[model samples]
Target: MGKSQKKRSMRRHNPMRVPDSHLPKGLAAASESSSKTEAILPIIQKMQGADAAERKWACVAVSNLIQNDPSTRRLLQGKNIVGTLITRLTDSEEEVVVEAAGALRNLCIDGGYDICAEMYNKSILVPLQTFVPKLSTTLSQYLDDQKTAPENAQKLVYEFANNVITLLWCLSETSNKALNAINQLQLVPFLISFLGARQKIPLATVTAAAQCLYVLSDDNPPAIADLRADGGYIACLLSILQEPPQDEADPRTGTLRVLAAGILRNVAPLPPPSVASALDLDAEIVLPQLTPLLSISLTEVSETALQLLGSAPETEKPKDSGLKNTPKSDHKSPAEVGLERLENRLRTVQLALEILTGACATLPDPQPDVLIDDEDDDEEGDENSDDNPDADMATPEEAVPDSREQTQSLPSLVTPLLQLIQPTTLSFPPLAAPSPHPPTTSALSAIHLAAFECLNNIFLTLARDRHANAADVGAVWDAIWTALGLVGTQTGLGQEQRRAVWEAATGVLWGVATVSRGIVEPKPEQVQALMALCDGATADAQLRVKCIGTLEALAQNPAFVDANATIAVYLLSMLPSANGPSPAGTEPMLQAASSLIDIYSDEDAPWDINFRSGGYLARLQGSVDGIKTAVRAIDRRKEGGKELRRRGEEVRDNLVAFIKYRKDLGL
Candidate 1:
C-alpha cells in the first residue's frame, strides 16, 4: 500500500462516534445517561421559559435527549411530561411556545396520539390551533402600523401548527383525534388567509396545513370532506399558488405544493363532474390565474401549475387557434414586436406548454400537418408567404425540426426548470459584481425548492401510474440530480434547508432504486454521479449525513449493490467514532460506523444467497467483496462486527417471525 493507503489501512478500527460538541447536548447526554427520563425532563422544562431563543435552545436540547432513548418508554407511559410541556403553549414569547410545541412534537414522534392526548389534556392543542388567528390579527395590525414585528409571529404560528400537525400524524391512528384537531383548527382557512399578505410568512404554515390535509385524506376520507365543507379546499390550494415565495424559495412551499397536488389527485378522480363545481372552481377562474403563474419564470410555480393541471380533468375543447395560440397580452410576439426568432419563439411556446401541462410525460396526439412537396415547394411557399403565414402556421409536426428526436432526451418540462436552478458559481467568489440587481440567496433557494417539488411530483406519478413514460422519468431525474449537486454548496443553502434538500433528494434516489426494478440495469454511472456531488471535499456535515443516507440506500438495492459496493465501503469506513476517544487526524470521524455496519449486515442482505438463487445470487456475490472488506476492517480493530452482526441477525429473525406470526394471525 502507498503512504496514504497504508496510513488509512493502518488506522485503528474505530466504531463510529460523533463528537459531543457536534451533537446537540441534550442528545449526547440522553445517549450517555444511565437514566433516560431522568436526563431529559429538566432539559424539556428549560424549553418552557419566557425567552423565545432560550426556549428554542431548550427545544433542541429536548429533541436531542430523546434521540436514542427508547428506554424512556416507561417515563412517557402516563403522559406526565407531555402534559407539563403543553402548558407552555400559551407562553408570552412565541419562541418559547415554539420550542415547547417542538418538544411536544418530539414526544409523540413515535408514541402517537397517546402522547398527543396527554398533551391535549393540558389544553395545548387548543392554543396551538388558536394561536394562528391571534397571529393573523396581530400581523394584520402590525402591517397597518407598517412596523415589522420584532418576533417572527408568522414563523411562531407556523411552528405551533407544525407541532400540531406532527402530533396529529402520530395520533392519527387513534380515536379520530387527528381528524378532530384538523377540524377544530379549520387549518386550511387559517393557512389560506396568509396567501394574500404583503408581509412574508414562513413557508412552514402553508406546508403544515397541506400535510395535515394529506394525512387526513389518506387516513380518513371524511376528514377531507370536512375540510371541503369548511369552504376553502380549492381556495386554500389556489391561495398558495398565488403567494410569492421568499427570495430563497422555501421548501415548505414545495412541501405544500406537493400536498396540494396530492389533494387534487385524491379528489380529482372520484368527484363527480358537475355543471357548477362544488367550489365554483371553473377552469375559467383557475386557468386565467394559472396563465400568469406559468409566465412568472419560477420553476416551482411552474411545476405546481403543471401538477394542478394534471389533476384537473380536460373538460372542454380549446376555442380554436389550438395549443400554440398565444393569449392576448400587451407584450407582442417577436414577429408583432419585430423581434421574433422562429427557434426562440418555439422554445417559449414549449416552456409555456410545459408549465401549463403539469410536466406532461406523454405528449398529446400530433397536430395535423400541411403536407409540403419540397420539389414543388418554392412556387407554393412563395404564394403562401404572401398570405398571413403566421395565421396558417406550421404544426409541431413540421416546426419541431429534425433535431428534436436527438435533443429531446431531457423532458421539455424539467430541462428549463433545471437551467433556472443551476448555480452560476460553483464555489464562493469575491463580491465583485456590480450589477444593477443581484440575486438574493432566498431567490436561489426558492428555485431549488421549486425544482425539487416538480421532480417529486414527477416521481410520484411514475411510481403510482407505472405507465409513466421512461424518457420523461430520465429527463426529470437528470434535472433533479443536477440540482441535487448544489445541496452542499458552501454559500447557497442554510444547514436546515440543505438537510431538507438532502432528504428530498434521498426520496428521489430511493425512488430510482425502487421504481427502476426489472426495467433497466441499476445504472452505476448515475449512482456514481450522485455520490460525487454528495461527497464534497470540504465535507459539510449536512452533506455527509445525506450522502451516508443515499449511500446506505444504494447499497441495499440488489441490482446496484455490486456496482456501488466500493463507494459504500469507502463511505462506511469513514464513519466517525461515537466515543470521544479521539486519535482522529482529519476532521474527527462522525459516529456513523455502527449505522454503516448495520446497513450492510442482515439475513435479508442482498448477498444472502441462501434464499436467493440463480444469476441474482451471482450478481449479489460480486457485490459481497466490498462489504466483506469493510466487515473485515470492522472485525480487525473496531470490534463492531459482533454488535452489527447481532443486530442484523436479530432484525432478520424478527422479520421471519413476524412473517410467520402474520400468517398465523391471517393479518
Candidate 2:
C-alpha cells in the first residue's frame, strides 16, 4: 500500500480518534466563541422560563455554578438572578421551589455578608415568609407518607425546609437590619414553634431553626422577648439537651445539642421580665447535660453531617459492611468517639458556662417590707384623715442590690468549669524553628479564655452570696490564681486573648476582695502581678482599669496596704492630667485614692500629725491638684463625664477635709 494510504487507514482504525461527523456540529467553534456572560445568559434565561422543568434545571445549574466559582456568583448577583429565584420560591411546582430555594441558599452560603444584605434589600423575607407555611405543610405530608413516599421525595422535602431555614440563618448573621427584618416578619415565633416537641420535623430542620434563633437573639432584645413568649420553646430546647438523640455518636444529635445549648445561652440574659420567665422554666435542668459537653471538642463533621447524608446515594450500603467479612477494622470505640465529639464542641461548653453566669446573676433578692408608723390615733381623727394619706407621703427609695449581688448557688457548675480551666498541654503543628517567645496555639487559648471567664463569674457569684464558705471561696481563688499563672506563662497569645486573661484575672481578684469582707486575704503574688499589669505599657485600657480597680479592692486589707503601698502611689499619680487617663479610669483611680486616704488618715490627731510630718501631705496635695485639673478638663455637659467630674470633686473634697483637719491640729 502507498504511505499516505497507510496513514489514512491507521487514522480510520484507531479507537481514540473520532470522525468529525461523530462530533456535535460546531461544538468546538461554539466553545471557543462563547464568553462567560453568554455562557450564563442561557441558564439565567432558563431560570425565568415558563416551563417548570426548565426553571428547575436552571436553578440547579445556577446553584452548582455559584458553588464552584466566585465569579459566577458575582455574575448572577449582578444579573439580579436572586429576584427570579425568590419568585420561584412560591412556584406551584414543588421541584421548582426546592431548586430555587437551594439556589438561593447556595448564593447566601458563598456570597458572604454582602449577598445576604442584597437579599434583604430585595425583600426576600416576604416571599420566604409566605413559603414557610406551605413548605411546612408539604413537609408534614411527606413525613406522614414516609413509608410509602419515594425516599428521594421525602429527602427533597427535607432539603427544601433545611435550605429555607439555613438561608434565614445566614440572613440573621448579616447585620441588625437583616435580623430586624426577620423579626419584623414575625418569624421568630414560627421558628420557635418548629422546635415544639410534638412537631415531627426533620432533625436538620429543627437544628437549623435552633441555630437561627441563637443567631437572631444574640444581643437582640426584641427577638429574645418573642422567643421567651413562645410557651414551650425554652422547655423544648431544654428537653432536647436533657434527652438528646439516643445515638450519642450521631453528629446530628451532637449538633442538635450544641445548637440547643447555644439558644439557651442567648435566652439567659433577656430583660428582667423575660429572664424571670426563663428562670421559672427551670432551664437549669440542662446543666448536667452541658457539663459533659464541656470536655467534648467540636468537629466540622457535625456541621457537614447533613450535607454528607444528602450527597450519599440512597441505595449505597453502609461502608462498615464492606469490612464485615475481613479482620475487624480499627474503628474508634464509642467512648473514644464521644470524647472526640465533645472536644469538637468546645464552643458549646463556652456557651453553657455563659448561661450559668447569667442564671446566677438573675436570682431574685429578698424584698424589704415597708415601714409603717405604729403611732395610735383617735378613730374620729383616722376617719377624718385623707383616704389615701400614704399617697402624699413620698416613698423612701429602696436600695437596689448590684445584679451580681443577687446570685444563687449552682454547685453543679463548679466541677465542669474547674475542669475546663485546668491547664493541659495541647498539640500544635511543628514550628519552623524554636524561638524565645512562642504564641499560644489558638485552640487552647480560646478554651483558656472561656474557662477563665466562667471562673470569674463563679467567683463573683460566690463573693456576693453571704453564705459562701471560706473553703469554697479559697478554692475559686486558687483556680483563678492557677489559671492566671498559666496565662502569664503562655508566650505567644494574641493581644485580645491576653486582654481577656488580664480582665478575667482582675475581675476574680476584685470579686474576692469585695466578697471576702476581710475574711480572705489577698495573696502577695496576686497583688504584685496586678501592680505589674498596671505598669505594663502594652496593657489594654480596660485591662488597666480592671487592674487598678482590683488593686483598690485589695488595698482595703491592712496587710495588702502595707505590702503594696506603691500601688496607691501609682494610682494617685494617674488622677492627674499628666497621666492622660481616660474618663473610665477616673472612678477606679478615685476609689484607690479614697482607699489610701482612709488607710493613712486618722480620727485622732496623732496619725494625722504624723502623716503631715512625713511629707505625705505634699504628695496628697499633688493628687488633689491633679483631680481638680481633671475635673475642670472634663466635659460636664455629658452625663457620663458629669458623674466622673462629680467623683473627682468628691475626692478633692475629702483630701481638703483631711488636710484642713490636720492643719487645725497644729501640725
Candidate 3:
C-alpha cells in the first residue's frame, strides 16, 4: 500500500480512539448516531428469531438499551421493535412472554402520547387482555396448590401480572381511545375483584391492579360504575389502607396506599348514589389514618393524603433521624431542597382544596329560587296570599331550616388550612441572596390560593348548613382579609399568578359576604379592599366583575347601603362602551349594573346626596346610550354578532328602567 493510504488505515484501526465529547459537535453527533444504528439491526434480527432463548435475550437487550436514553428509544421505534415485542407477548414460551412484557413496559416509561397511540394501533391491547385473565386464573390455581407449586412459580405470576398492568396504566394515560378500549374489554371489574381478594393475591399484584383501576376510572364514568356496582370495592380499599406496612423498607406499601386514595378521589365525585355510598363508609376511622400521611416528607404520600382527605388532615412531621447529621455531598443545597419540598407541599394543599370543592357536590342545593316553579298556580297563589309585600323577600335565615344543629358534625379542616396560609420562618437561608428567583414566591402564592379556595368551600358549606356561629364566621372572614392583603402586596409575582390570587381572593370574599349576609356587618376596610380590586386597571376583568358582585351582595344589608352608593357610581362608570374590547365582558358588566341599580333603589339607600353629586343619573343615561351604540355597531348578519346585539339591547333597556324609576321617585 502507498504511505498515505497506510496512515489513513492506521487512524481508522487505532487502539485508542478519541472520545465523542472531545470531537467536533457534528462529528460527535454523527458518531453517536452511527453507534445506535449499529446496535439496532442486530437486536431486531435476534428478536425476530424463532428460537425462544435468542428472542428473550434480544428483548432484554433492547429493554436495557432504551431504559433511559430517548435517542435509543426513537431509533428502536423507527426499527419497529415494538411490533416485534407485541408479537412476542403471545409467544408460546412463558419466558419470552415475560421478557417481551418487560421490554414494552420500559418503552412506555416516559413514552407519552405518540408511543401509546402507536401501541394501540398495533393491537397491543388484544394480547394483553387475553393473557391477563389466563395468567390470573393460572396464578389462582397456583395459590390453591401452594404446597406442590414450584418455588418461583408465584414470583413469576406476580412479575407477569405487574408488567401487563403497568403497561395498561401507561396506555390509559395517553388518550381516551386506549382508555375506552380497555374499558370495553371489561377488565375493570376483574381488576377490582383481584383487589377485593387481597389476602389471596400477592401484594405487588394487588398494588398493580389498584393502580390500573385508578388510571382507567379516573374521569371515566363507565369504569367508575363498574367499581361502584360491587359497593364493597371502597371497603376493600379501606381495608388495604388500614393494614400497617410490613416494615419501613416495604416499597409496595406507599404505592398501594396512594393508588387506593386515588381511586377514592375518582369515585367520590360521581353521581349522588356513588357519593352517598362513599359517604356511608367509615370516614371517622379512615380520616385519622389519612391525616398523619400529610406531614410525611414524601411528595407522593402527601399528595395522596390530600387526595384522600379532599380538603381534610393534620399530623406532626415525620423525623428522618438517619439523614439528620449525614455528611454533605455534591448535591443541591439545603435551600434548594427546602424549596422543592415546599413546592410539593403546596401542590398537595392545592389538591386538597380541589377535593373540598368536590365534596360540596353532595350538599343540598343552596339556591331555592331555581327549584321554585313560577308556572305552578299553587306557588303563585301562595305568594299572592302574603299580605305583607316584604314577607316574600324574607332573608335566607328565615327561609332555610337550621340544619346544622341536626346534621353530623364534620371534621375541623379549617385549622390546618389557616396554618398553611400563615407565613413560615425559613430555617435555611433565603433563596434571593445570590440572585432573585421566583420558586419561593411562586410556591407561597400557590399555597395562598389553595388556602383561599379551602376557606371559600368551608364558608359556603357553613352558609348552606346554617351552622356557622359568630366566632367561626369571624375567623373565616379575618383569614380571607389577610390573604387578600398578602396578595395585594405581592407586586413581584407574574400577572397570571397575581390574577389567580385575585380571582381566589374575590371568590372567598364573595362566599364570606354571602354566608355572613344577615349575621355579620360589613367593615369599611373590607369594602375599601374590594373597591381597590375593582378599580385597579391591571386587575383581570373577571376578578373585577366578581369584586363588584360581592360589593352588591353586601349592599343587601341596610347598614351598608350608604357605603355602597359610591360603589354603585363606580359600577356605572365600568359599563361597556361601543368601542370597548372583549364582547364577553358585557354579561358580567350588565350584571354589575343591575346590582348597582338594586342597591340605589333600596329604601335605606342615601341616594339623595350621593346621586346628585356622583352624577349617578347622568351616568345611567350615558350607559344606556353607550350600550345602544354597541348594539348598533355589531354586525346583524352573523349569529354571534346578533346575539351580542341582543344582549346589549337588553342591558340598555334595563339601564333605562333604572333611570326612569329614579326620575319618577323625584330623586
Candidate 4:
C-alpha cells in the first residue's frame, strides 16, 4: 500500500486517535464481534500488514463510509487528499489505485473550471490521457496483479475515461473554444485508433467525434477537407460504409446516413486527388462504392451523393453538363466510356435495386427464434476483478479490418443493407387539412428518400432506354404525375416545401423532355389540359414562366404541328402585341405568347398558318366579341381602373394586326 494510505488507515484504527463514531457501521452493529485490539490505531495499522484479506476489508470500509457522508467527500478536497490520490495512481497495489481513480472521477463530476484548471495544473489530465495507451502496454506485464485485477482496473479506467468525455461533451456544448480543443486533439483519430479497444468506448468516442464534426463542418465546405485529413476521416467513414449492415429492425442505417451526409456535404466539391495514378484510390475506389449508396433509402444520402458525384473527374466537364444526365466524362479513361458505359452501370444498379426491393418486403415480418450458445459469458467473467487480463479487454481481429483489407468489397453487404431499408406500404396518417377530415389518398412522402432516389434513378434509366423500357417509362411518368398531384394538394405542406415540390416536378418535366420525348403525344385532351395550364400560368408569374418553357417544348413536337392549326394561330397572337387582353389572364397568356413566337420562329417549323382564313380565321373572329365585352365591363369600373382599359386596347390592336397579316397571306 502507498505510505499515505498506510498512514490514513493507521489514524482511523489507532486506539489513541480513533472515535466510536469512526467505527465502521457494519462493525459497530455486529453483536458477537468485539475485538478491541482491531479498533486501536496501532492494531489497525497491523491490519494493513496482516494480509490481502485484511487490506480488502479496510478498503471496503473506507469506500462505504466516504460514500455515506457528504462531509467525508468534502473532506477529500484537502490538498493532502489530492496528493494521496495521485500517489495511488502509480501504486503497486492494484486495488488502491482502482479505488483512488474512482474517487477522483466522482470528484471531477460537475466540477467547475477552477477544479478542472486545478486538475490540469496538477498534470491529472495528462495522466488520464495516457491511461488508454498505457493500458495497452501494461496488459501483458501486469496480468497477474490482483484478485480480479485487470478487469477491475480496466473498469476503473473506462469509467474514468467516460467521465472525462462527459465533461468534455458538456464543455463542447457550452463553449465553441472547447469544441475547437476537442477537434485539435484529433480525438476523432484517437477514437478510431482505439476502435481496437473495447466496443463501448470506441462507440462513445466516435459518436462524440461525429457530433463535433457535424457542428464544425456546418455551412463551411473546406472544413470538411480539413476533417478528412484529420486521421483519414474519409477513410474511416468509408470503413463504416464497407462494414456489413446490422439485421433488419436496427436503426443504425439511418444514423449512418446522417453521419455520411454531414461528411459528404462538407467534403463537397472534392478536390482532385494529389496522386495521378489511373486506379486513383480516391476516385475509382471511392466513386463506385459511393455511387451505389445514391440508392440508399435516405434522401440525404442521395443528395450528398449527387453533390459528391458532381465533384468526381474534376479534370473534365461531362457532355451533359446539366443536372439530370449522367456525365459521360465522370470516368478518367476511355474504357470507362463516360455516358456510353451507362448500360453496364444500369445493370449493376438494377441488381442492387432488386435485392433492396426484396429485402424491404421481408424485413418487417417476425421470424422464429433460433438462439445460439452464449459465447460472451465466459469472456466477461467478473467485471470487478482485474485478474485475468486477457478476459474482455483483448482486441478481437474480426471487429474491424486491417487498413488494406478494409478497401476490399464486403460480403453479404447488399443483402443485409437491403433488409434494413425494405419499404413497407405507407399509411397516410392525417395531417392538418383545409378542414379536419381524413385524406382521400395515401401519399408516398413517408417513404425513405433513399428509396425515392432509387426510383429517380430508375426514371433516369428507363428514360435513357425508352425503346426497351417503354412500359417502365410510362409507369414512372404516372408515378411522377401522381406525386406532383399529391404535393399540389393542401395536405399541410408549407409554401417553401410546395415550391420545392413544384421545382422537382419541373425537373421531372425537363427529364421527360430530354430522355423520353418520343413518347409524348399531342392528343386533343392533352392539348386542352396544356392550354388550361397555360391560362393558369398566365395568371401566376412563376408558373407562367415554367409553363411557357414546357409549352415551347410541346410546340417542337411534329404531332402538334401536324394535327392542330390552332397551335400556329396561338403562336402568332402572343407576339408582344396579342389579340385583345387574353381573357384567360395576363402573365400566363403573355408568357405563352412569348414562347409560341419563339417556337414558330424556329428554323424547322416556321409559322405558315393563316389566322384570318378557314377554321383558324373563324376562331380568331369569334374571339373578338368576348374581348369587346370584357373591355366594356372594365371601362365601367372606377376611374382609377384605366390601366385595365389600356391593356384591353393593346390586346385589340395586336389581334387586328394578327388578323390583317393572316388575311394578306392567303391560306
Candidate 5:
C-alpha cells in the first residue's frame, strides 16, 4: 500500500513531464538497417532540434509521406524514424507532441503489425501512457469547470486525447506487450472517465475512448471486473449505445453507438440460457440485458449500412441524360463525400459486426475447467486484490471470448450479415483513376472482409438452429461465395488484403464443415469456388491446401453428394486436357477423388447418371497412371505437401477400391 501510494504521488507530481536529461534514457535500439537513413535523416534531425516549429513540421512531414504509401513507410521504419517519434511524444511543445503522436499512429497503420510490435519493443508505451493521466485530469476539468481553458485550448486537448487513446488502441490491438503495459498503467478507469463525460468532450474523442476500452476489455478479467464493479461504466456505454430518435442529425452518432456496443460485447457476461444451456448463467437476470444489447446492434448494423448506401452521391449524368445536376452548396467534391461516407459506414458496420459475432458465438467445446473448481468454495482467496500488479490485466493468452450468445435474436441478423457480404456500389461518376487502374486502398473490400469474418462465426450457430430452413442455409452459402468473387476479383488489391479476405471466406466454409457437419449442406457452385481457390495461383499454397481439406470435409455430408458428383465429373473431364492452360493441380483433383469415394462409401448415396452409364470409372481408370504421374509430379517440399501427398495417396486407394467394388457388381 505504501509503495503504491508513493508511485501515485510521483506520477501526480509529474503526470506528463519528461525532462531533457531523461529523454535520452529510452529503449530505442540502434538502426537495424542504415541503408535509407540518409534520406530520412533530415527529418530525424529536425525532430530532435530545439526549434519547436521544425520539430512539429518534421512529424507532419513523416505522417503525410507515410499516409497510404507502403514503400515510403518501409523506408521511414528503417531510418530509426519510429524511435525518434517515440522521443518526440514527450516533447515540451504541445504542437510537437500532437504531431509526433499522429506520425506514430500513422506508422502503426502504414507499417501494420510489425511496426506496432516494434514501437512497443522500443518502450513507446511509458511515454505514451503519461498522457492518459494528464488527459484524465483534463477530462476531470471538463466535468467540473469547462472554462479551465480557452475554447481553442480545450479543442487542442481534445485532439491530443483523441490521438493518444487512438494510438494506444492501435498498439494494444497489435501487440500483447503494449496491452500489458496499458493495463499496468491503470488506463481503463481513465478511458472510462472519457465515456462518463462524453457529451462534455468531442464525439470523436469519445469514439476513440470507446474503441480503446473495447480493445482492452476483450477477455481481460481485471478490465471486465473494473467495468462491472462500476455500474456507471456500463450505464455510460449503454447510454451511448441507446438509439437516438431518427430525427437527430449527429453525423458521428452511428460510429459512437456501435463502438459502445463493441465495448459491451467484449465485457458482457456469459450469454443467457438461449445460447446453449442455462445451467451456468442466471438466465432471468442476464437475458433481458443481453437481448436488448443485441437488439440495438442488430438494428444499427442494417440501418447504418442502409444509411451509407443512401449517403452515396447520386451521379447526375448531365451528358447522357441531358439533365442539369441540382444546385448545392459547394464543399468537398462528390467523390470525396462518397468515399468518406462509405468509409464511415464500413467502419460502423465493421465494429457492429464484431458485436453481432459475439452475440451469436458460443464457447468452444468445453475443456477441463482448469480456472474453476466446482467443489471448492475457496474462490474468495483467489479474488484479485489491490496489491496484485496485474489484478485487472489479462495476458493475450487469457483474453478469451466472453458472454457472447445471440440465442433469441441471432436469426434476425442473418439477412444483414449476408447483405454486407456483397460489395456496396457507389455511383461516383468522377472517381476516374489516373492510370486506368484501381486505387491502392479500398473500403469496399474491407467491408466484405469484416462481413466474411462475422459470418464465419455466425455460421456454426446458425447451422445449429433447426429453425433456419434450407433457404436460409442456401442464402448464407450463396452470400459467402458471392463475396469471395467480389473480393478475389478486386483489382489493385495488396497481397495482404487478398490473403485476409480468402482466409476469412475460407474460414466460413471450413469452420462450418468442421463443426456443423450434417446440419449444413454445401452447394455445387460452392464446390466450384473451392476448386478454383485450390488451383488458383493467386491463392498462396497454404490456403490452397486448406481449400482442398475443406472440400474433403464437405464430402462427408449426404447433401454434399451433388457437389461431390459435380466435382468428380469436372475433374475427370478436365484431367486429359489438364496439362493445357487450366490450373487443375494434382492436389485438387486428388481431393475431389477422395470426396467422390467418401460420398459413395455411404450405401444410400445416389450415383450421378454420368457415373452409371457414361463409363466414367473406366475413363478414370485409364487416367490412373496419369494421376500417379501428377501425384509424383507435385513438389513434395512445398507448404502442406506432406499432408497433401498422404491424402492424395489415400484418395488413390479409395478410388481403386471403389472401381473394384463397382466391377464386382458388374456395373
Candidate 6:
C-alpha cells in the first residue's frame, strides 16, 4: 500500500535525522520516514491542538526534523503540514507563530525551489503580511528600553524578527507575486530600519534584513526602485561597507557589507553626478566610501587570516606553557575546532570573492567593466583602452551601469586566485594525519569557478590591452587546462560550474596567449588533451569550439607550432569534401577556417612553422576544393553567421596565397 511506502529522497537523508531527547526511541531508530509516523504524526496532532505549548513544541520539532533531510520534508509536506503551519501564522500564541515561521523557512531550505513554489501557491503571503509586521514593534520596544527589557524578551523578539525576515526572503525568491507583494507591503523600508540600526540590532536580524534586500533587489525593477527611493536603506548598506570585515566569531563579520555592495550594485548606472551628489546620492562621497571596501576585499589574505585552513587547530596554551593545554573555546575537540576554522575561512574567502566580482560586474562579459565609478581615470598600464577597438585589448562597450576601470589590485589578484584553484592532488594537501579539514569538492569547485572568472577578465583584459605582466601565466593556464579536462577525474564537479571554469579558463589562455605566444609554454600532453576533445563526435559543441580556440591561441607562439600543425591536419579531415553536403552548424567549419587562417594566413611565418613548409599547408592545398565547397554550402544556409561567412572568405584568400607562395618557390 502507498501508506506503507517510503520516499527514496527521504531515505538518503535519514542519516541527518535530528536528535531529540524527548522523541520516541523506536521512531528515532526507524530506517524510513513512513515508518516513523509514530513520531511525526503526534507532532502534527500537537500542532493542530488547543495547547499552545504543545503546538510550539511541534513547530520546532518539524523544523529540527527537516534541517537537511528532504525525505522527511516530502513526507511532512504530503501530510499537508504546510497548510497547518500557515494557520499558525495567525494563531493567538506569538511563540507558536515564531516557531511556525521557523518551520516554514526550514521547509523552504530542505525542499529547495519546489517547496518554496508550493508555499507561495498556498497563499502564504496573505497571513505573513499581517503577522510579520508585529515582529518590528516588539523589536522596536526592545531597542528603546535597554536595561528595562528582560533578556529573554529581547532574545524572543530577535528570534521572531530574524525568522520572519528570513522567511520573507525565501518567499520572495520563489515567485513574481510574492516579489510584488514585498514592494506593495513596503518591506524594504522595514528591513532598512533594522539594518540601519547597525550596532543596536542583533547581527542575525541585520543579516536577515541584508540577505532579503540582496535577493529581492537583484534584477527586480520594483525592488530596486524601492531601495533607490529609500536613501536610508542605501545608507544602511553603505555604512556596513565602511567597516572592515570583522573577526569571524565577533558578531560584526562584514557579511552585511558584502550584501550591501550587492544591493547597491543592482542599482546601477547609478544616477549621474546628481545621483551621486546633487540629484540622488552624494556619489562624490559615495565614490571614496566604496574604495575602503574594495581595498580591504582585494588585498591578498594575510598569513594569520588563512593559517587555520593550512594547519590543524590546537588549544590555547597558558603563558607559562606549564599548565595543561586549555581548549581554545569551551573545550572543543581538535576535529570540531578544525572544522569550524575551515568553515570560517571558506565563508570569508567566498564572500570576498563575491565582492571583488561584484565590484567589476564580472558576470555575462569576458572583460569585466567596473559598474561603480572610480574618482580617477587612472588607466595604469592599460594601453588599449576604450578608444582603440582593434587594439589587442579593446575596451568593452559601456554596460548599462556606469563604467569604471578595473580595481587597483585586480592584476595582482592572480596569485591569490591561483592558490584557491589548485590541481586535484593539491586539493587536499597533507597536514599531519588529521588535516585541517580540506575544502569540500563543491566548495573548492565554487572557489575555482569564481577565481577562474576573475582570471578570465584579467587575462582577456591584459591580452587585449597588450599588457605583458600576466602574473603567473603558466600556473593560471595549467589550472584552467586541469578544469577543462576534469570530467573523468572529478565527477562531483557541477556542469554549470565546470562550464563557467572552461569559459574563464579559455578566456584566460586566449588573452595570455594573445599577449605573448610563449608565456604559457605548450606541453605535448596539453595539445593531445585538447585534440582528444575534438576527436569525439559526442563531445559538447561549446567544448569542441573552446578546445579548438585554445589550440589556435597557443598556435600564435612558435613554441606550439608543431602541436598546432598536428591539430590542423586533424581539423582538415573534418572539412566537407567538395562533392559532399556541408554540416548544418558552421561552428566546426568556422573553427577549422579560423585555425587554418591563423596558421597559413601568416605568409611570412618562419620555416620552423609546419604549416606549408612541413607538408601541412600542402595538405590544406589538397583539401582546398573540399574546404571551399563547405564555405559555399555555409553561404547557401539561411542561418549561416556573418562572421562564419567572413571567416570562410579569409580561408579562401589564405589558400590562394598558399598556392602562389608554393608556385613562387617552384615546388
Q: Which candidate is the best by TM-score?
A: 6
Off by over 4 Å in 1: 1-60, 63-83, 90-95, 106-177, 180-186, 195-200, 227-236, 242-249, 269-667
Q: Worst 10-residue stretch by lDDT in candidate 3?
A: 1-10
What is each predicted model's overall lDDT from 0 to 1?
Answer: 0.43, 0.57, 0.58, 0.39, 0.57, 0.57
Model 3: number of backbone collisions: 0
Query: What clash count does candidate 4 reach?
Result: 26
Model 1 global lDDT (CA atoms, 0 to 1): 0.43
Clash count per candidate: 22, 11, 0, 26, 4, 12
1 or 2, greater by TM-score: 2
Candidate 5 — which residues are off by over 4 angstroms? 1-42, 243-251, 270-341, 363-411, 424-441, 465-467, 470-482, 489-493, 507-529, 535-598, 608-667
Question: 471-566, model 2: which lDDT tens digit per residue?
Answer: 365676677777666555333422345455566667656666666534456567777777777666233554565676666555555544454455
Task: Give the winner by TM-score: 4 or 5.
Answer: 5
Q: Write the per-residue lDDT of candidate 1 for residues 1-667, one digit (tens) a residue.
A: 0000001122111111111112233434434533554545544445555556655555545554553343353244333556656666767766666777776777665344445556555666566667667766765775566456555554555566667656654454334544465566655554445444423555555455555555555525555665556434555555555566453333344344444544543343324333224442313332243233233344343333334334423333324322121221222332322111221222222223323333322222223343334443333223213443244334334433342332232233444544554543411122243211111222334345444444444443344344344344445456556665655533321234454455456555544433454233435766665556555424453444444544554555566456445544555345323322212212212323333333434545664342233222222223233332333333212233333333323332333343344245331
lDDT of 1 at 575: 34
Write model 3 residue lDDT over 184-259, tens digit each, in one string: 8777766776677667667767877876787666657888887766656767776676787644444455556656
lDDT of 4 by residue, 1-667 (tens): 0000111112111111011222233423432233221233321332244454443333333333333232343333332344445554565665655555654444443232333344444655444555545554443333345344556665565544444444343333333334445454444444444332323332433344444444445433345557556445555554655566443232333343344444444454434452212233423443344445435343332333334434544455445423221112223433223322232232223323332322222111122233435444332222223444333321223322232232222212322232223322221222332211101011112222223333333333333332322233444445555555544433233223333344334434533443455456545654554455555444354454454455555556655554335555554354332345554454334444444434434333432342223355555555555554554455313432344344444555455556566566555
Candidate 3 vs candidate 5, TM-score winner: 5
Residue 171's lDDT within candidate 5 is: 75
Q: RMSD of candidate 2 to the true fold?
A: 17.8
The alpha-carbon RMSD values of the candidates against the true structure, listed in the order shown, are 24.4, 17.8, 15.3, 28.3, 14.2, 12.1
Checking candidate 3 for backbone clashes, the offending pairs are: none
Better of 3 and 5 by lDDT: 3
In model 4, how large is the Cα lDDT of residue 203?
Answer: 42
